[model samples]
Target: MTFSKPYATREALEQTIAHHAWLNEHAGSLRLPAIRTVRADGIDFASIEGRHARFTDAPAVATVLGRAHAAAWKGDLHRALLTTAHPLAHGHELPDFVSPRIAALRRHRAAGLVNAHQMTAAQSLLAASPATPVAFYKDTNLRNVLITADGPVMVDLGDLTLAPFGYDLAKLLVTLAMTYGPLPPATFTTSLACYNQPLLGAGLPPVTIGRFLGHAELHHLLTLPYLGKSGYRHPWPTVRPRPEDLT
Candidate 1:
């Protein structure tokens, strides 16, 4: 993405370029794209080298999340990030993203924009889940992941941070649903189980589709104001799987 006026300052552009360089130094081990940064005539541009396909399907999403999570949990890489204490590491900030005020949700609900039942369920899920923070790639949305012949590669490495165990996966799952509607109930269950195996292996907490969907719903509600009423459409169908069906 080009870093230009009305979007980012010159200092911000330079910082991004430096961060890309730092990430590239560990590209081989981390499976990240090599970014080539350029500046010309007062405009700065950053381009990822090599041809890669965007991961679009549910199975692809599961596979990539498993691999990325495994990599992030590796002893040496995990230690390196923690030791550096990078400013990008958003400590205890994931809750803020999913936990919007009741008054705000009420406003949306009153406008017929958010479902009252869904909002209550989401709040319950967040309350039940553990609040302890863990190191995570806070921005694992599909746009940042690409598929090459070898495997998936993550770009936009700047958002590495600390959040609850499942926040990253939840973010991607929600983004997937937003882009291409919700997955079938069986499909969602299978995918969650697939990714959870690695987390279990790493001694990290397994993600529940129920809790993540709760997060997804709240996130969707939060974005509506920014997206504007005219530009928004609900991603899930009316015939959704019952709450009991989610794990």
Candidate 2:
């Protein structure tokens, strides 16, 4: 199987390793494995053996991934709240391709299209939300998670960078939609239920959580254009966008 381009920095590798270490250290609380970095080809790699979490024959692997992702997002959110003096201080850079809401609306009108325009507009809304705090993930997807007997272990951390809090959830949702087809409404609701509880517990306002989800969704939709062009294969099935799905 092909892997995406290797993670470029030692710092990225270390951050991922640290996340695993944290998970392991709090295994009783988090129930994830402690993974260590292994050096090879001048790049750092890590592994969580197959024996750790078993989803091989599980029909609900997707659901498992969904919950794991929700849990992880909560963990990250909690950490962001506790350790950082300024919640929004986490440095998440907006990608250059993201169009502002006005521009997106214009693009929508000019093209008479909806999906792209709507996606862009949503992104703009996310950017404008003051309550949304950003955090970084090296790689945020189900593929990077290993299912061992112990639990799920997040493995890759190469592309880690801070972004809006719910960005990972959006990415995961989009991936699931793409991979498994348009998500059942139940999936989205269930995942959100898991995701929202923690944010509320962390004293985050509901609107902030909504903004984060919007950002995540927008980020996923906008990034769809460039997915397969990179060495990384698209994780979900590609479908022509319906006119309604567009802006």
Candidate 3:
């Protein structure tokens, strides 16, 4: 993929290489594009093995996430990644990536990036809960998912980390919501239940869906300025979320 701005640090690139290497060997049923080659500037992704799909394709998104949620859901892979102390695994807590972004927003508020109100709201949301850790494929969002004839494929391993249970699901839901307005109440609730199934089956505590949604919202709010008016279906924060909207 091409990017106008560089997307990786040396350290993150190394971790991504390692993670993909691991996936190449171990991702049995998880669909991933083959890493064709790696060079100084970037890695090459192989041509789509099936039909190229759009991020807006809802069915495709669900199918891919289901594959990930079930096939690699919290068990051996979680322990294996932890055992190796994988650099991509931000152990047992949500990474502190948000704090630095908030700081940057404050510093650039004069540039109209984020206002004081948004910053304060973000801080409060950050304090809402001590997120319970679960196996989070942090980059499992609409932008990174692809639907192929074989099934669904997820791409971008750079941000995989151990984060709050459903963090990855929340990110996907939030990404879709931001792009297409709030999901229907039934859809939101069903999605939450589906994401919590594996954890519950494993006798882990169920995710607090609201808290996960809140955290996901904060993540997208912090991301707004960078979007530079991409014409999303809804403007966030000002959208005044409804309880049913997240149910």
CA lDDT, candidate 2, residue 219: 47
Model 3 lDDT on a 0 to 1 scale:
0.56
C-alpha local distance difference test of each model: 0.52, 0.44, 0.56
Q: Compared with the true structure, what per-residue lDDT tens digits does model 3 show for residues 156-196?
A: 77765444456566666666666667656555567666656
Candidate numbers sorted by TM-score from highest down: 3, 1, 2
Query: Which candidate comes out best when scored by lDDT?
Result: 3
User: Per-residue alpha-carbon lDDT of model 1 for 148-202, expressed as tens digits?
Assistant: 6665566664444434455666666555555545556666677677767767776
Instruction: Report the candidate with higher TM-score, 1 versus 3.
Output: 3
Question: Tens digit of lDDT per residue, candidate 2, span 1-247?
Answer: 2222244565554444555554343222333333333453223333346532122312233343334334444554334421232222233221222233335445554665446557456646545333344344434455655666655555554444444445555555555444445544455455555555555654554324355445554545445454664322443334323223332
- Give the worst 10-residue stretch by lDDT in candidate 2: 51-60
C-alpha TM-score for every candidate: 0.60, 0.53, 0.69
TM-score of candidate 2 relative to the true fold = 0.53
RMSD (Å) per prediction: 6.1, 8.0, 5.3
Q: What is the lDDT of residue 26 in candidate 1?
A: 31
TM-score of 1: 0.60
